[model samples]
Target: MLHYIENSKTQVGKELVLMDIGAEYHGYTADVTRTVPASGKFSPEQRVIYDLVYRAQEAGIAACKANNDFWAPHKAAAEVINKGLTALGIIKNETDKHPYFPHGTSHYLGLDVHDRGTYGPLKAGTVITVEPGIYIPEGSPCDRKWWGIAVRIEDDILITANGPENLSAKAPRKAEEIEKLMIEESAFNQLELPKLD
Candidate 1:
């Protein structure tokens, strides 16, 4: 994305991307996504929104545990996202349901990207994903302080006898961490390819 933004002449306005990646191994699947600034460093507006989703994802992951209701994570995540939006003055009130965040947090992960599992109490060893997002396009009802910014944080989690374990923990999720990763020299950076006429 940094390369694209730097190399291309396209002007950025209210454009955002929500990238989803899933890999299947041994019949099980993993799903995750991270939205970063195409310019490598998050702008002020983008940072706030990104942090909100990150904190919400953390809250959702904490709710994934044995014997807890399957929807607990979603509820937990929604509450955090709702309150954050309210506190940031992005929305009118925390009690008011906002369309900006309209998806559940967790789903089973197995044969399919959205694997099948009981909506009842979560059992130990259940693999799931905790993803929370916020999307605010240009010209929305809210203030311009929160426009053209879209963010989603996702991580694969596993229910354990004790608590939740993050399977994709190695992946960088924090704003600073992402910035660092983006700036690091890529393996392909030094390779030169000859242009064909």
Candidate 2:
């Protein structure tokens, strides 16, 4: 979903807002995503889902090291997601297919969001993204209270011999940190953009 969706009616007191965005610097591109509560605060259910995704992303990032295969991070992320979803009764067990999280956790991010890197062993100096998500739209098999909740915490990670370095560290990812930053007044709050047709 690399397209913009217009929803000017969106405002405070909303549920979740996912900003799956990217930027181009000179020629190289960077992909980053930050999911936040629309009301500058998270409801109990939203917080639960958000935290699960955050933990899964962390696990995925931790697995992104030199000598590890590209699938290493995905495997690690899926394990966390399966356990979390199982605890919530969203699934039977960790060995389940894990329908909630159905995407790759890491991918090469450079000239394009999915860079042209060899699908082999990870090496130092490679930059990748760790994005784990849980999408339970309406009509999902989970409890009704868990419906309409989707969250993903993404970060540009630099693979190194030492460990993974989060390039987008300054951007808040935790539920509380995002709330704090959202509460802080922004310059854009004063300026208004013209309505689109």
Top model by TM-score, which number?
2
- Tens-digit per-residue lDDT, 71-186, candidate 2: 88888888889899999998887887756777788889888889989979899999999998998878888789998888888899999999999999989888889999988998
For candidate 1, give the lDDT of residue 181.
90
Best by lDDT: 2
lDDT by candidate, in order shown: 0.85, 0.86
Write candidate 1's Cα lDDT for 102-177 as tens digits.
7778889988999887799999988999998898867878898787788888899999999999999999999999
Models, CA RMSD each: 4.3, 3.3
Candidate 1's displacement at residue 117, Å, is 1.3
Which residue pairs show backbone clashes in model 2? none
TM-score of each: 0.88, 0.91
Candidate 1: pairs in clash: none
